[model samples]
Target: MITPLIHYIQEHATFPLSETDISLLEEAFIPKKLRKRQFLLQEGEVCKYIAFIVKGATRQYTVDEKGYEHVLNLCIENWWTSDRESFHKETPSIYNIDAWEETELLLLPKANGYYERVNIIPAFNEMRIKLDDNQHMAVQKRLNMAQNYTADYRYEELTKLYPEFLQRFPQHIIASYLGITKETLSRIRHQHLKKAS
Candidate 1:
């Protein structure tokens, strides 16, 4: 399980972790499981771990001052999750991470101190930078899309972003992630389906 993870990271951005590097990572990580709705981190608590999901799904969201819930993101198998601000600065989190289904995860601390001993492959640093850059770009796009795109375009882009979501996640969750009410999502889906037919 861990081997493919290390290999995938190495191949994607040139992390180039040798067998030893991979093994060291495996040694430090702890595996944990959560039943549905279990929380890995909660609002106002310091987020200490960056988790890699090996199975099931999780959602990161927050309740605003008006009591409206805003969906931040959903993570499935082979994805990593945490509040980036909290993870990076070691501060209290503003978001909550809850499992949508029963989940299994591998976790490493943000300041694990393992990176200091294991060589920082230049490629690995680049990979981390690229991930952060891409996430920032995506968030910016999402904010603009919410304000500017029609419900139809938003739905289209939602499919483009998470093509597997319709089949994998529950519909209401998908609607929430798309920043729409379930009825709005239903209307958009109906329109799309009618056009396809």
Candidate 2:
């Protein structure tokens, strides 16, 4: 069940881990299950856990003053999802995270000393920097698209990059993620299908 976490770590680690290190990792993680529509974190709550999805899907989002949801990220198998600032600083989160499907996760609690253990890994710094860099680049790309691309263009780009997202997530959720109205997303999908057919 924790194979996903192990694989992600191994793939990103700058140096190979020994059996002892593997045992340490296994000891540090706690498995959790979330039913569909269940919230892992809510706005204004301090996020204490960072979860690695072993199965199912989740969405991280925030609601505006007018109560419109704006999705920040989506996670499926092998993805990590968390309210980063809240987790690190023990501050209230602006984001909410919920399971989109019945989800299994390996969670690391902030007070568990997992970070100290992880830091001892030979390539920990390298792995951390790489993950941070990738996330920063992804955020920049999304910001650029939001500023310059039409809803249709952004939807197409998202589909091209994550072909299964359309099928995996509800249209309304996808529309929110793309910062578009559901009606607009429906129109875009209809037009694209018509063109294809």
Q: Which parts of model 1 have CA positions greater than 4 angstroms off?
A: 65-67, 115-123
Off by over 4 Å in 2: 123-125
lDDT of 1 by residue, 1-197 (tens): 57645755776675456667666777766788999999999999998887888888999999899987677898988788988789778899999999999999887775658544433655556666777788889889989998998878988987887787677778788888888899998998998999999
TM-score of candidate 2 relative to the true fold: 0.95
| Cα lDDT of model 2 by residue, 72-163, tens digit | 89889988889989998999999999999999998877776886786687764466678889999999999999999999899999989987
lDDT of 2 at 36: 99
Worst 10 residues of 2 by lDDT: 119-128
Q: Return the lDDT, model 2, position 106.
A: 88
Using lDDT, give the best candidate's number.
2
Clashes of 2: 0
